[model samples]
Target: MPERTETSPAHHGHQRSPGREQLETATTVFALLADPTRLHLLWLLAGGEADVTELASESEAARPAVSQHLAKLRLAGLVQARKDGRRMVYSLRDGHLRRLVTEALSHADHQVTGAPWHA
Candidate 1:
């Protein structure tokens, strides 16, 4: 066992490039996520794959709205869908994206509810 730190100094050596391309791309993804409904959908998908009906029921949004959000998320490369027989099951496309959404919502919860933040 060893002492733990929030971040290791060696990790900073792998920082992403400062090129505008990454910034612009991230901005586009954030723009797509601006809607609450879409963000909720992403949160659900981050947990695991689910069909539109489950998402709608859990999120309390209309089925059509959930479908539309899933479509947009799929198009934005944030999520993926596959036909499980007649049903289309959806999930996050990248593992990094799952953590990104989870971390963001956790941070928001802390801010909205005045909970203590943890790294």
Candidate 2:
């Protein structure tokens, strides 16, 4: 068996199995993502970092709702926020999450629009 490196993919290329903690954490992430409003917020952040105003405006969801959603996502470590003067700027925590949100929405688009799935 090849030695696992920091960048190695889990499972298929090795024998490393997901532990209970990993499984539980992933389930929690999915649970957080189950809400359509939250999913939309994540999808927006995937584009680029933005403040609450921009997110609320673009999402067409109320500003308070956007703030609450961002708070939940931030607590989950899915998204991060930084103070930009008086406004709070928010963005995905890492490339993995960015790709996850993008791919999930893309899959939904395919399902809704009857687009053919790619391999």
Q: RMSD, each candidate, Å?
A: 4.9, 4.2
Cα-based TM-score, every candidate? 0.85, 0.86
How close to the true structure is residue 21 of candidate 2, measured as C-alpha lDDT? 92
| Alpha-carbon deviation at 62 in model 1, angstroms | 0.4
After superposing candidate 1, which stretches have Cα over 4 Å from the reference? 1-14
lDDT of 1 by residue, 8-119 (tens): 4325343544479877988988898789999899898888999999999999999999998888888888888999999999989987778778888988999999999776
> Which candidate gets the maximum lDDT versus the true structure?
2
Q: Each model's C-alpha lDDT?
A: 0.85, 0.89
lDDT of candidate model 2 versus the reference: 0.89
Over 21-116, each residue of candidate 2 has an lDDT whose tens digit, in order, gives 988998999999999889989998889999999999999999999999999999999999999899899999988777778888889999999999
Clashing residue pairs in candidate 1 are none
